[model samples]
Every structure is written in C-alpha cells, then in structure tokens.
Target: MLWRSPRREDAYEIHELVRQCPPLDLNSVYNYLLLGEHFSDSCLVAERAGSIEGYVSAYIPPLTPEVLFIWQVAVRESARGAGLGGRLLQRLLARPAMGRIRYVETTVGPDNAPSRAMFLRLAGHLGAPVHESLLFDRSLFGPDAHDDERLMRLGPF
Candidate 1:
C-alpha cells in the first residue's frame, strides 16, 4: 500500500471509509473535508491497487504553532494490520510544513484501547510527552453530572 496526500477527487472514497467506522458522525464528513482544505493541513490517503484503503488527517494551528493535532485516522477493515496507519502518520510527521512541530496530540475514548495504544506507540517513538486526563463537559443538571460527560484528554501533546 502507498500513502499520499489526498486530492479533492478522493473525497468520496474517504467519506465511504469513514462511514464504515463506528463512533464517527457520517453527517459531518463534508465539513471535515472543508476543514482540511481551509487549514492547509495534510489529508492523506493510503491506496492499494488504485483504491483508497485508509486515510489520516492532521493540522498544525497557527495559534498553537508547535503542536500538530492528528484529528482523525481510519483504515478499511480489510486493510487493518498492514501498517498503513503508521505509514500515514509518518508521512504527516515528515511534511515540510510541519518541520517545526515539536508535539503531536490526539484524544481517544478511554475504552478504545487500540486507538490509545496507537497514539502511545507513536508518542514513544517521537519522544514526546503524553498526558492523559479526564475531559469534562458542562451538563444541564449540575457539576456532579461530570461522570456522564467525561472523555479523555491525551495532550497539549
């Protein structure tokens, strides 16, 4: 498999692959594509035999100059375990535009071991710090309702 930057032409295949992943809101794919274009970030695709098998999107915000946020990464079920995800990450990290980046960050659900493991391994390889914390959202009921709104915060890188 080969990883390359995504073209506008690859939107359909990227959307289809993202749709197959659970916990993803398929309705927002169009907006996601727009975000990538607007930010000049990398939206990369992994292709095999002329078909897109996976993709990863990453952005380095000007406000947070030294940090790269890996927004999303997904691989087709048939393409899993092929190291496509790692390759896509490596390509994103190697981008000239990101040369000044000192940290890479991402958030994963606490129970999502595979996603967490992926980020951990990447963090280790890059020798960056990974801080895991409980992410809480405001709730209608009260502050004690934090349990229902908790997620994980795995960075500032």
Candidate 2:
C-alpha cells in the first residue's frame, strides 16, 4: 500500500472507508475535507491501485503540541488483519512534522478490542506506558446510544 498525506479529493473515499468500518463514528465528508486541507500533516491515507485501503485522522492539540490526538482509524474490510491499522499509525508518527510528538492519545469504546490492541501494540513498540481513564460518559452522547469512550494514552516516547 502507498501511504501518504490525504488530499481534499480523497475525502469522499475516506468517508466511505470509515462508513464501512463499523463501531467507528463516521464524520461528515466536509469534516474529512477539512482534515485533509487543514491537518494534512497529522492525517494519513493508504491507497493501492487507486483505491483507499486505510486512513487515520489525527491532529496535534493546540494546547498540547506534544500530544497527537488520534480521532479515527479505518481500514477497508478486505484490508483488515495483517497489521494495516497499526502500520498506518506508525507511518503517521514517523512524519517529520510529528517529530516533537511525545505522546499519543485516543478515546476508545469499552469493548473495542481491535482498537485497544492496536494501541497497546503501539505502546509496546514505542516502549511507552499505557494509561486509561474515563474521558466521555455514555450519557454524554445524548440519545445516540453510544458507548462510553475512555481515554487511552501512551506517552513519553
């Protein structure tokens, strides 16, 4: 797979990819376009044969430039397994603009084993410690029936 920063033109494909990857909250295509145009340094896309295979949306928080806040990770159904998700994250952190990033943070639903595992593997590779804490309560999602999202942080890498 060819990994690179996303372009505004890739938003629709990225949206479709996120839609296909369930348990992942799909944001509006316009939001995705903004991620490409404004946060291209932290977001990434994996394409092969002109088709989007994976994507990761992340940004360095303004108040915490050392932290890379990952918003979403999506891999096409056919691309599941073989560590594509983790690879996407690794490539994202390897970007020159991310050189100062010393921590990675993301919220994951309680039962999302795949996402949890991916982060754990990343922490292991980085030789960092993983810390979990309550970030968002289920009720905070209003009437959407969303699960509680807890913060998972890997730091000082």
Candidate 3:
C-alpha cells in the first residue's frame, strides 16, 4: 500500500469506500474537497496497485490551534485489516504542517468495536489517553432520554 495526497479525481472511489461502511454519508466528501483547498497538502489517499483503497482527511482547526482533528477516515471493505488506516494516520501525523498539533482527535460511535479498537491501538502507539463519553438522545414517542451510549475519544496523537 502507498500513502499519498488525494486528488480531485479520487472523489468517486473515496465516496464508495465510505458508503460501504456503517453510518454511511457521502456529503462529507464534497466538504472534504472544499476543506482540502484550504489545507492543500493535508488530505491523504491510500492506494494499492494504482487503485484508491482508503482515504483520511485531517485538519488543524484555527479554533483549536493545537489539536489536529481527524475529520474522516475510511478504507474499502476489501482493504480493511491491512493497516491502510493506520498507515494513512501515521502519514498525517508526520506532516510538517501538523508539527504544532500536539493532539489528534476523532470520535467513534457507540458499538463500533472495530473503530474503537483501532483508536485504542493508535492511542497506545502514541501514548495518548482514550476518553469515553455517553451520547444521549430522546425518542420521538418517549418523554425520557436514552440511556448511556459509548463514544470514544483517543488522542494527543
């Protein structure tokens, strides 16, 4: 696998990869390209045999000057478990533009064990802490809010 910056042309393939995952959303791809323009060299692509296999879009928001937020990360189902996600993340972390970023953060939805595990492994490698939180929501037919739901935040990457 090879890690490189994403090009406008890779949008479709990236879109498919994200679509195949749970909680699918494609609108983010367009936003990613728009944001990519501002952080030109930060968006990345992972390819194998000349085909796009995965992608990650990370940025250091001005409001959070010292933190690098990993806005999105997705690997083609066929490419999962091959370390492409980790490779993309490692490349992002090494960029000189990210030097001032002391922490890298991402949110994994409750019940997403694969993602949670990946974040835990990455946090271990980076010596960062994994913070957990509960996400509550109200039902359309109910008065009481939903109970605890796990969301993980692994960072300081």
Top lDDT model: 2
Residues 1-157, model 2: lDDT tens digits: 8999999889998998899998999899999999999999999999999999999999999999999999999989888888999999999999999999999999998999989999999999999999999999999889989999899999889
Supply candidate 3's per-residue lDDT for 58.
Answer: 71
lDDT of 3 by residue, 95-129 (tens): 88877777767766566767777777788888988
Residue-level lDDT for 10 in candidate 3: 73
Q: Counting only residues 3 or more apart in sequence or on different chains, how many pairs clash (N, Cα, C under 3 Å) in candidate 2?
A: 0
Q: lDDT of model 2 at residue 21?
A: 90
Off by over 4 Å in 3: 134-151, 155-157
Q: 1 or 2, which is superior by TM-score?
A: 2
lDDT of model 3 at position 31:
70
Candidate 1 residue pairs that clash: none
TM-score of each: 0.80, 0.98, 0.81
Query: Each candidate's root-mean-square deviation in Å?
Result: 4.0, 0.7, 3.9
Steric clash pairs (candidate 2): none
Cα lDDT, model 1, residue 74: 88
